[model samples]
Structures are given as structure tokens and as C-alpha cells.
Target chain A: MFWRKLLNIDSKIIYVVVGLALLLPVIKPVGMPVSISEEYTRRFYNYLTDIPKDAVVFFDLSFRETGEAELGSSVLPAFELLQKRGVKIVCGGQWQQAPFFMQSRLEKKAEEIGSVYGVDWVNIGYKPGGTATWRAMMEDFWKGAAGVDCNETKFDELPLMDRVRKLDKETFAAIVIWQAGTPGSGTWMQYAPDIPLLAVYMGGIGGNARYLRSGQVQAMIGGMQQAAEFEIITDCLGDATGLLDAQSLAVLVVIAFIVLGNISWIMVKRQDSLERSS
Target chain B: MNMDPLIMLEAVGTIAVLSYVWKENAAYRFFEFTAIGLVAAHSIVQTWNNYLKPTVRDRMIGDGEWYLLIPAAIGLLYYTRVMDKKFSWLARYPISISIGYSIGYSLAYSPRPFLKEFRNNFASFGHVNDYIFLLVWLLVVFYFIFTLMKKTKKTLRVTGAITRCLIMIYMGVLFGTSILGKFSRLLGRYQFLLRDWLRLI
Candidate 1:
């Protein structure tokens, strides 16, 4: 009976419980300690911190709107670190929707820092041709970037672009990729294999592991756990840390449900077996 | 209580989308359709502006790169698929070209990076962690070997069993991490609902 009750509970009830678990924390903050288990996040943080000012870095903001909640939180703090260091960034998007996210972040933080467009930073916007686009960018940077910045300004007009003509180790200091899926870090890895690449993956550790195993990605932050870790480590309080409470509460609720279900199932099975044997 | 129209729409959409967790209905369907339509429209506009405008339209006329027309012609051949049977084969030309290009590109580039990593796996085991990692990696690789004969040796069988167990453990860890990832994403939607739209937090 207990097993049946546990298994057949109304789905709506579960939804309401999970919803509240997420909601209550956001409304009233509980200062839950966020643990930093991933060593790579600290490595990534340190790597980004040590990069000299005026060192041009190509950042691929390839996360679309759907990934904003998870990946965006991590990027905001990382972008702040980059801005704080005065590291010149060449932002580009492999995904079409990525530009809006990148633009909004800059409008908020970069503008406050008095960072100038085209001089201090430039956005090449969406590059359509996946691997071929990266290869082409390597072949001829301006041609591959379509010879214009994200604003449709000619590369020749941008002061930063005057020094950088192609994608190579000598031209750029490093590549930081904030990616959700393919045509992102993978494309960058395949084309620009030699460049020191840092990737923040908002996905499964399985995929992230492969890139790490292959040494294709020099550093990585794979999930919001690491994102929260990065925010705490950087001392920049942002969305990822804010949402960690809800995330942990929801996860605990689900785990509790799972454990209860398993216990009830085991008790019911034992009762049935004893009855049959008797 | 947000009075902004954009916030209002977002709040409504978020609730509508989340409503599917209980049960699907008209509100969910309406929002879903609207989202799909918006995304399709956005993609179309972006593709035309970011891709087609510069590559096809501008390059042809403004740059005098008339030679780019060859690939454009090959691309047009893909439209032959919806045409009559005689023209359908024309589609294969572009498909084959793309496939060949992809294969050659992968062959020329992919191996070195992976091999570079594979070489690192063989470096001197300086630490206990390194040895354990190498052993687990080898066992996981062994789990995939499908050539075991019906009369395989007892040691091989035991090794295979151990390999399978290790792989299962690896998979379980990865699955657990994936659940955590999804939970974070779910929390993101809630953050938007409370912080951005409702302004309650």
C-alpha cells in the first residue's frame, strides 16, 4: 500500500513542491555554503586573472537564450574579471542569438568601466559556417569574420583590428569559449588546436571530460556548481550564487522522493515475498 | 507586482511554459506555438542578414567576386530535391561535395589533437592519482572489447567483469552530474520568474 501510494502520488503535487522549493529560497535568502569541488574552476580563475592587460582574447559567446540562465551567470562574473583586468576582448558568436546576450552584458558592465567599442573591444557577431568558418577565420581572420565587426563596421576602421589580422597564437593571447553545444568549443578546438583554450560548459561532465581528456580545452567550468564556485572565488556576487539555494533545495527534494520511493518499494516487496512463502 | 508590459508577457509565458509540468492544455500550447514562431522568424531574419546578405548578395555585386557564383550554383542544386525525379540527383552533387570536404577536414586535423592527449596518458606515473587514473582508463577501454571468444580464459572474464563494473560507476557519476546540470537550468527559469519579471527578490 505504501509503495503504491508513493509511486502513484499526483504529479501536480510534485510540481508544486519543487516549484516552492525553488521559489522560497529566492524570496528569502538562506546563506548556504557553496562548496568548490572542481579544481579546474580555480585554475581557470587564476589563468584569467594572470593574463596581462591589453592582451587581446577571443571569447566565443556561443550560448543561446535557452542556456542563459545556467551559462550566463558564469559568463557575467568571468566577463567582469576580464573587464577588471582591462583585457581587450574580441567577442564573436557561433550561435545567432549569442550576440544579444554578449551585447547586454557589455552594456551593463563594460560601459561602466569606460571600455570603448572597436578600440578596447570588438564583436564579430555570428559566424555561420561552423568548422569551416573557424578554419577560414584562421586562414584569413578579417575575411572569415566577413571583414566587418558585429556592428557592421569595417575591420579596417577599428583600432584593435588594425593590429590583429588573423587567428593565430601570435595574434591572440588566448581563446575563452562559453559554450552550450556543438559548433562551439568543439569547432574552436578542431580549427584552433594550438591556441590555449578555456571553455565553460553548461552541460554534462561526460562531454566535458572528452575535451579535458584530449587536452583540447586547457581549463573548464562544467556546471553551475563550478559557476557558483567561480563567483565566490572571484568575490563577484551574481546570479549563479543567488540561484544555488534553489538548485540545492530542489535537488534535495528530488533525492528525498527517490529515497522514499525506493524504501517503500523494498518494504512492499519483502511483505509480498513473506506472504507467498508463508 | 510588475507593471511593465514586457515583464508581464515574460511572467505569463514562464507560467504558461511551466504549466506543462502539471498537465498540457491550451495555455501551454498557445505559448509553445508563439515561442516556435518567434524562434523561426528570428532565425530566418538572422540567416538572411548575417549569412546571405554578405556572402551571396554583397559579394556578388559589390566585391566583383563573380567566381563565388560557382558554389552558389552548387547550393541552388540542393533545391532540386523538391523538384521532379530527374533533377533530384542534382542535389547529390552538393551533398557529396560537403561530405567529402567534412571527411577530408576531419582526417587532416582531428587526429593530432587527440593523439597529443593520448600521448599524455602514457607519461611516467608520478603520483598515485595518475596511476589510478591510468588503470581506470585502461579498464574502461577494455570494457568495449567485443572480440571475446565463447571459450575465453577465466582471468579475461574476470577482467571483463571488473571493466564493466568500473564503466557502470563512471556512467553513474556522469548521469548524476547531468541531473545536477538540469536542476541548475530549472533554477534559472525560476530566477527569471522571481528576479527579472516579478521583481519579488
Candidate 2:
């Protein structure tokens, strides 16, 4: 009866427990030690560190607002690191709302680091076209971007833009994409294979392991855990690090629920089978 | 408590959206529709202000690139799908062109990378991991050969079972990662609710 009752527990009860697990840590952080992975986060940092100072790098903010927390955390520290290295950044997006979140964050980080706009960084923002747009960018950057920055300022006006005439190896040092889904790093890997591609995926890092192993992707940071690890390594601790405790607790609660549910299910099944056999 | 209007509005919207998980209600429905409407409207405005407006202003008018209208007209043909039954086929022009161009483009560029990936699978045989990869790859491929499997069902039963297990493991890993992604997003909302809205953190 107890096993049957446990098996039949209301989903809302699980939800409440999970919710508390998430909330408690945020209210009072556990500051659980986060061990950084050499394969994902460290490789990502090493690649950024190795980027030659004052070289241009393209940042593809190819995620929606929903992905901001995970991908955006990675972007902040990456921006800081690149800025510290004196690398020029030119930002754009495949996802429409990508720039909406990223531009302000970049601007804020730039201000803190005393970096100038147009000269140091330029947001070309998002264009509606997808792969064709990327293909056009490979052929001619300014033309593909419709000759305007996010604010409708001409690319000719931005010093950084002058150097980024095309999105090829000669022009940009590397392409770092904060990817949520398709029309992302894969698009770059397919279209502009010549340029080095670094990816920060919101999730599904396992799916992309093949690309990294194949050397199609130079480096990758997978999901929020890696994002938090990145923050620690870069020494630019932010929301991801703060939220890690909550994330860990919530995951634990979920696993516990899964185990309990499975045990209850098995017990009920065994009891029913024994009765039927009799 | 954080009293910022924007943050307050976000909090309300977030709560409304999350409320659906508990029970379907008017607040959830209203907010859900609002989100859809807002995103659609934003997409339209962004496309106009960022892309179409500038192209028309600078390229077509200022730069005297009137020939650009030819492509624009073709793109507009997509809207014909909503017009009338008689002219719905007009949308097919743009659709065909897009599909044809994509296929041509993929054929031109995608093969090299795919070939590289395929070659890499067979490139290394030194490591134990490499042997495992190769064995699993072959087994999975052999399992999918429907006619061959049917012909030698008894002989290949063990191979098929092993391949199925490997595939299931792969799927489980994929599903696990997907769940982690959702959890991260949920944590993001929790962060917002605590730190941004309630200021509890």
C-alpha cells in the first residue's frame, strides 16, 4: 500500500520539492566546489588566451532570450577576457533577440574595461536571412550586413568594421558562437570551414562531441555548468557562479525523486506479480 | 524588494507563465498569447527597421541599385499563399527557388566537411577507443541494413542487440543533456524570481 501510494504521488508534490531545492540555495548559497573540465571549459579558455592581441574576432550571438542565462554567462567572461587581450570584437546574430540581450551586456562590459565603441567593438546586429546571409558574409561582410551597424551607423564609420571587410580567415582571428540550436556553429562549420570555430552550446554538448573530436570545432563550452566553470577560470564571477548551487541542488532533488519513483514502481509491480502467481 | 517597473513587469510575466505548470488559468493564457504576439511583432519591426528599411533607403534609392527589387519581388511572392486559392501556387516559385538554391549550396559546400568527418572515423586505429568507435559504428550500420538483417536474423541477433544497446545509451545521453538544458533555463527563472524580483538573494 505504501509503495502504491508512493508510486501514485501527485506530480505537484515533486514540483514543490524541486522548486524548494532550487530556491533554498539561491536564498542561502552552498558555494559547492565546481571542478572545471579540461576538455570543454579549459580548452575554451586556452583558445581565447592564445588569440593574438588586437586581432578581430567575430561573436555570433545565435540564441534567444530563453538561452541568455546559460549562454550569456559564458559570453560575459569571454568578452572581458578578449577585451583584456585587446582583441577587437564584431558582434552579430542568427537569432533575432540575440543582439537585444548581448549588445547591452557587451556595452556594459566595454564601459567597465574602458573600451571604445566602433573602434573596439561593433554590433552589426541580426539580419533576417539565414545560411544565405552567412554565405554572403563569407563573400563580402559589409554587403551581407546591409552596410549598417545595429544603430544604423554605416560600417564605413566604425574603425573595427573597416578591418572586417569579409568573414574569412584573413580578416577575423576566430568565430565564437553562443549557440542554442541550428543555424549556429554548424552553419559556420559548413559555410566558413576555413575560419576557426569555437562554440558555447546551451546544451546537447554530447551531440556535438563528434565535431570537437573531429577537429571541426576548435573548442566548446557546454551548457551552464561549463559557463560557471568559465566564470571561475576567467576570474569574472557573475550570475552563473551564483546560480550553480541552486542548479546542483535542483538536479539532486530531481535524481532523488527519479530513484524513489522507480523503486516504488518496482515494488508495486513485484507485489502484483506475486499475488497473480499465487 | 526591487521596485523597477521593467523588472516588475518581467516578474509578473514569469509568474503568469510558470503558473501554467500548476494549473491552466486566465493569467497563463493571457501571458502566453502576449509573448507570442510580442515576439511576432518584434520580428516584423526588427526586419523592417534593420533590414528592409536600410536596403530600400541606401541600396535601392541612394545607391541606385533598382535591380535589387527583382529579388525583393520574388521574396514577396511568398505572401501569395495567404491571398486566394487560384494564386496560392505563386508561392511555389519562391519556395522552389529557395529549395533549389539550398540544395545546390549544400552540394557545393557540405560534402568536404562530411567527407572529413567520415574519413576521420576511419583514420585512427591505434587506440582502444578508436577500435571501440569503429566496431560500434560498423555494428550500428550493419543493424540498419534491413534486408541483410532479415536474411541473417539468427546470425546477427547478438550484433543487433549490442547495436540497439549502444544506440539506446547514445539516446539516453542525449536526453540527459536535454534535461540539463531545461534545468539551466529553470534555474535562470529562479535566479530572476529571487534576485531580480523578490530581492531575496
Write model 1 residue lDDT over A1-278, tens digit each, in one string.
76868777887888788778877887876868877765677788888988889888988888777678777877767777887788888888788777775687766777777778888888888877677777778888987778787677888899998867889888888899887776777676667778889998874355466566557787888776677788898887777787777777887998898898788888888888989999
lDDT of 1 by residue, B140-200 (tens): 6665664364146776677778887887887777777777666666777777777787677
Q: What local lDDT does model 2 show for residue A26?
A: 75
Q: The CA-based lDDT of model 2 is what?
A: 0.86
Per-residue C-alpha lDDT of model 2 across residues A1-278, encoded as one tens digit per residue: 99999999989888888878877887888888999899888999999999999999999999887787788888889988998889999889898888767788888999999989999888989888788887788898888888888888888888888898888999999999998887788788788888999999886487788888788899998876888999999999988887778878888888888899899999999999999999
Candidate 2 deviant stretches above 4 angstroms:
B84-86, B146-152
Considering only N, C-alpha and C atoms within 3 Å, which residue pairs clash in candidate 1? none
**lDDT: worst 10-residue window of model 2 chain B:** B146-155
Question: Chain A: TM-score in each candidate?
Answer: 0.90, 0.96
DockQ score, prediction 2: 0.61
DockQ scores for all predicted structures: 0.54, 0.61
Q: Estimate each model's TM-score.
A: 0.92, 0.95
Error of 2 at A141 (Å): 1.1
